[model samples]
Target: MLALPAAPAAAGDIRATVRDRDGKPVADAVVVAVPSGGATGAGIPPGLAEEDQRNKEFVPYVLPVQAGTRVHFPNNDNIRHHVYSFSPAKTFELPLYSGTPTSPVLFEKPGVVILGCNIHDWMVGYIYVSESPHFAKTGADGKATLGGLPGGDYTLRVWHPRLEGSEQATARPLAVPATGAVDAATTIGLTPDFRARRAPTPGRGGY
Candidate 1:
C-alpha cells in the first residue's frame, strides 16, 4: 500500500476580536485579508446561487465569496426585487427575476458590495468577497480566526454595512510570524441604524 502525503501546515493565522467604541463585540463584522502584492493563489470553495425576493427581503442577509467568484439570483417570492448598488466593489442589478437567471453575478474585485432592492426600498444585504482564502466570518461571539495565511505582511481590513468610510482607510498592517500566534484588535464606528423596514406609504399620486 502507498503511504499518503501529509497535509501542508498553515503558514500562520490571524486571530482577531472586533469591538465598537463601547468595547462591546460587534456582530456581522467582515474582516478581509489582502496581500500587498495584489495577487492570490487560493481557490474559492464552490458557491451557491442566492435570491433576494419581493417579500421585501434578501434570502441570505450576508454572503462571503472569494474574489472572481460568481453568484446567482433566483426569484423565489411572488413579488419582485430590484437589486442594485453604488458601491465601488461591483455595481449591478437584476431588475426583477424569477427562476434561474441566464448568468450568475460576478465579483471581480475584493470588497464589500452592498445590495438594495430599489422596488422595496427598505431591503438590503451585503456581499463580502475576500481576496484571500484565509478568512472567516465572525460568529455571535465576535471572534474570527483566519488560518493558513502565508507568513508575510498583510493589509487587513474590517468592514460592516454601517462602516464610516473606505475599507482601505481603515485597514491595518500586521506581520504574520512564521511559527507563532498574533492577536489583532480594532474598533470601528457604526452608523445609528442597521435594520430593514417598509417604505413609507406613497402620497396620493397626481391624477
Candidate 2:
C-alpha cells in the first residue's frame, strides 16, 4: 500500500493592500481568505462582539466577524435607537431602547449584514459575516495583515461598504509560501459614499 505525503503545516503571513480606483488607500475594507480545501472559521472561540450606538451613529461603522458569532448592540447615547437590518445575511430588529439588550444577535451565515436605525435614517452600519476565520479589516494605511496562516491555496476576497460591484467579483486565487511572508494587493472601484454626515457629538467612544 502506498502512503501519501503529510500535509504541509500552516506558516507565514499575508499582507494585503487595498486601494480605490484612483489609487487611494481604502480604510475599513474587509479582507477574507477561504482555503481551497475548506477553512474552519478561524477557530474563533464563541464570544461576543459589540456594535455600540453612540452619538446617533454605529461605532466602528464596519465590523467583520466569523460566522456563528454573536454581536451586542449597546446604546450609549442619551437617545433611544431602533436598529434593524434588511440584509439577507441576518435580518432582525431591536426595538427602541436606551441600553444594551439582554441578549446578543447570532450571525450564523456568511454574507454582508447592513444595519440601520429606524429612528435615524441617516444612521448606517455594516456587519460582515465572514465564512472563513481568516479575515482582517484594512486600516487607515489601506493595509491588512493576516498572520500565522498555514501555507496553502486560498481564494482571497475584498469587500467594502461602497464597493461598486459584487464582492465576489473581487476574489482572486492565492498561493501562500510554506515559510516567510507573502504580499498581495487589490484595487477596488468604489461608488461615492452616500452616508449622511452629522455634527460631532460629545461622549463619543470606540467600539
Candidate 3:
C-alpha cells in the first residue's frame, strides 16, 4: 500500500513498556498512539504487513498495521490453509491455498482482527489495525519503541488478545517531545488463553 509523503515537524519517539498486574512483562501487546490533531497516517511509511502460515501456526503471532493498509497471508507450509477473520473491522475468507494469494486483504478500519485457520483450531493470530501509524507490538521483554512521531498531545493505549477488559479502559494521555525519546507505560489484566490445555503432540494435528 502507498503512504502519504508529508514529513512530521520536529519528529520524536515513544519508548514504551507493557506489564501485567503482577508487574511482569507482557508480550504480544500492541501499543497505539492517536494524535490530538493531525492525520495519523500522514508522514508514516508502511512496514511488512504479512502473516505467514508455517510450522502449523501463524508466525509473529501479533501484527500491528496502520488503517487502510493491505495485508498479505502466505502459506509457507507443505499443507494448504484456509485463513479467515470474521472480525467486525474487516471480515473475509481466503480459500485453501499455498504460497501466496493473488492479492492482499485491505484493512480499511481501525480495530482488532482475529485470524484463524479453518483446518487448524490451534492456529490463531491477531491483526491490530490502528487508526494511527504510530504503533508497535511489545517483544519478548515487553518493550517497544515507536519513533518518528512529531511533538504533540496524544492518547496512548495498549491492546492484548487476552486482555481482561476493553482497550479503551487502558487509554491515557501522553505528550510527545519534539526531539529525542520519551517514556510511556501500561499495566494490563489478562484472561486465560482459550486454546486447549494439552501440549503439541504427533499426528493429531491438521494434515
Candidate 4:
C-alpha cells in the first residue's frame, strides 16, 4: 500500500469582540481584516445587499458590504420613502417609493456611505464598502467571527457610527496562526451621537 500525505490544516478563524470606552459591549460595529501586504487571491464575489425601511427607520442601522456590491433599498412601511446618500464612496437617490426599487445601487468604491431618508430626517443608516473581503458586523452581543482566513499578517480594524476618531487609528497589526483561531478585542472611543431625534410620526422632511 502506498502512503499518502495528510491534508494541510484549514485556515484559522478570527473572533473579535468590541467594546466602548465605558466598557460596554458595542453592537453594529464593522470589523475588517485586511492583508498587511495587500491581498493575493481573487476578491470576494459580488452579491446583493439590502437596507430595509420599516417603522420609519433603516433596519440594521449599519451595513458592511464588499466593494462592487449592489445594495437594494426596500421600503416595508405603509408610507413611501426617499432614500439618498451623499457619501463620496457612492452618491445615489431613490425618489419616493413604497416598495423595492426597480434597480439597486452599485457601490464600486471603498469608503463609508451615510444613508438618510429625505422624508424622515430622523432616519439614518450607514453602508461600509470595504476594500477587503474579510469583514463582519458585530451582533447585539458585540462579537463577530471571521472564519477560513489563511495565516498571515493582517491589519484588523473596527468602525462604528459614533466612533470619535479616524478608522485608521483603530487599525492593529495581527499575526494569524496557521492552525486554530485568534481571539481579539478592541475598545473604541465614541463621540456624542447627534443624530436627529425620531418623532412619534413623520413630522417633516429634509435631513
Best by TM-score: 4
List the candidates' TM-scores in order.
0.78, 0.88, 0.88, 0.91
Q: What 10-residue stretch in candidate 2 is worst by lDDT?
A: 198-207
lDDT of 2 by residue, 26-90 (tens): 99999998888775534556568999998788998999998889999999988788899989999
Q: Ten consecutive residues with minimal summed lDDT in candidate 4?
A: 198-207
**1 or 4, greater by lDDT:** 4
lDDT of 1 by residue, 19-127 (tens): 8888888777877777778666454564654644535577677777777788887666665456788889998977765566788898879778888866666778888
* Residue-by-residue lDDT tens digits, candidate 4, 34-146: 98777733446879999999888998799899998998899998888899998988999899888899899999999999999877889999999999888899998899997
Runs of candidate 2 exceeding 4 Å displacement: 1-10, 197-207
Candidate ranking (TM-score, best to worst): 4, 3, 2, 1
What is the lDDT ranking, best to worst? 4, 2, 3, 1
Candidate 3 local lDDT, 36-122, one digit each (tens):
864674556554578888988888799889888888898999888899999999999998888899899988898999998877878
Each model's lDDT = 0.74, 0.88, 0.87, 0.88
Alpha-carbon RMSD of each model: 4.0, 5.6, 5.2, 3.0
Which portions of model 4 miss their true places by more than 4 Å?
1-9, 40-43, 200-207
Total clashing pairs in model 4: 0
Instruction: Output the TM-score of candidate 1.
Output: 0.78
lDDT of 2: 0.88
Off by over 4 Å in 1: 1-7, 41-55, 194-196, 199-207
